[model samples]
Target: MKILVCVKRVIDYNVKVRVKADQSDVDLTNVKMALNPFCEIAVEEAVRLKEQGKADEVVVVSIGPKAVQEQLRTALALGADRAIQIETEAAPEALNTAKLLAKVVEQEQPGLVLMGKQSIDSDNNQTGQMLAALIGAPQATFAYSLELDAEQVVVTREVDGGLKTLALKLPAVVTTDLRLNEPRYVKLPDIMKAKKKPLAVETPDGLGVALKQHQTVLKVEAPGQRQAGIRVDSVDALLDKLKNEAKVI
Candidate 1:
């Protein structure tokens, strides 16, 4: 059976984010871009399934600008069989992205679908669940571990108190959590081989999916700077400041 892994291009986790001068959005010019960490974990899991002889193929897909192909290539270098790019100038919102992915799911008919529990850039954590609902498939989110059986897949997920396990039937959706698996390092030879692998590009219009904005951004602004703390001579002074200046007490 085939496994489809969805990935996203995001700002590297290490880079310090800067707000644009006009406060329209985060400044992305010359920013260091990388695959969403959660997406990498999802791709790694799909590749492992193929390596263990459980899956016949692992296909990686991303929805973004032409630049997203760079991330698709990275997924191929990590062991995905092929890549598909849904070319768009700007990233769509969570619901629209889910709709687009639903179209891909219908066309691919993979035995299982895997993606990040949330994209780091947006952190909406709704795409996978939304896609599951739209496609009428069972979904397991925040998956920490997975076991593939003949007709069903068991997933252990992180919950509020502890971990919970569920068995989902074939042709299901699973979103990877942070502890799912560590992504392997990309090798130089694999990078070269990925270049030769099949990479297809499709647009939302071609997929019959509309990229509509359900919400509007009123304004983007930097957070207020925190004030520095002042040292007090004794507990009395601290209490005085708290009662008078800070007014906590």
Candidate 2:
């Protein structure tokens, strides 16, 4: 089986965020970047399948600026066979991103496509599903575990209260969740090898997809600061405040 894992470059979760002075976007100067956390799980799972001899090849793909080649190289270090990058100055909206990926899917034609449930920077979980629609493939989102039979796939997904299962034929899309397998770090030897591995760059128009936007961000504001609560002298005072002042039972 051939597998294609869709990954993304995102701002490092640890870095402090600042809104641009013009209020158009986030300030990215001197900010750190990395792979999306959930996409890392998908990469790890693909590597495992390749190691088990269950998969023939695993390809990593991403859509972002040229700097994102580093993220794809990171996945190659972790064990993907090759990578392709769709170059853009900045990442676009979810629908446009999906349109870019659908072109890659059409070109590669891998039996399986794995991606993250959402990207931390945008927190938009629509790309994978939208790509599936564009490519005319079945989609299973929030997958925690994946299993394969002769020609079918069984995906276990995380739901609100419990787990749910879905079965799909080959050439399907699966989006990963947090409970997926823990990702492994790249060893020193693999890092050097990954540098020499194959990586191709193409533009969105070169891939024959016109980026389209379906949503807009009016503005981004800082979250409200939490206020400290008053301290009560005794249990009776607390109860009195809850019942009369705060109006809670």
Judging by lDDT against the true structure, name the best candidate.
Answer: 1
Query: Residue by residue across 36-111, what tens digits does model 1's lDDT show?
Result: 9999999999999999999999999999999999999999999999999999998889888889999999999999
What is the C-alpha lDDT profile of model 2 across 62-116, one tens digit per residue? Answer: 9888899999999999999999999998888888888888888888988999999
Global lDDT for candidate 2? 0.90
Q: Per-candidate TM vs. native?
A: 0.92, 0.93
Q: Model 2, stretches more than 4 Å misplaced?
A: 231-241
List lDDT for all candidates, in order: 0.94, 0.90
Candidate 1 Cα errors over 4 Å, as ranges: 228-249
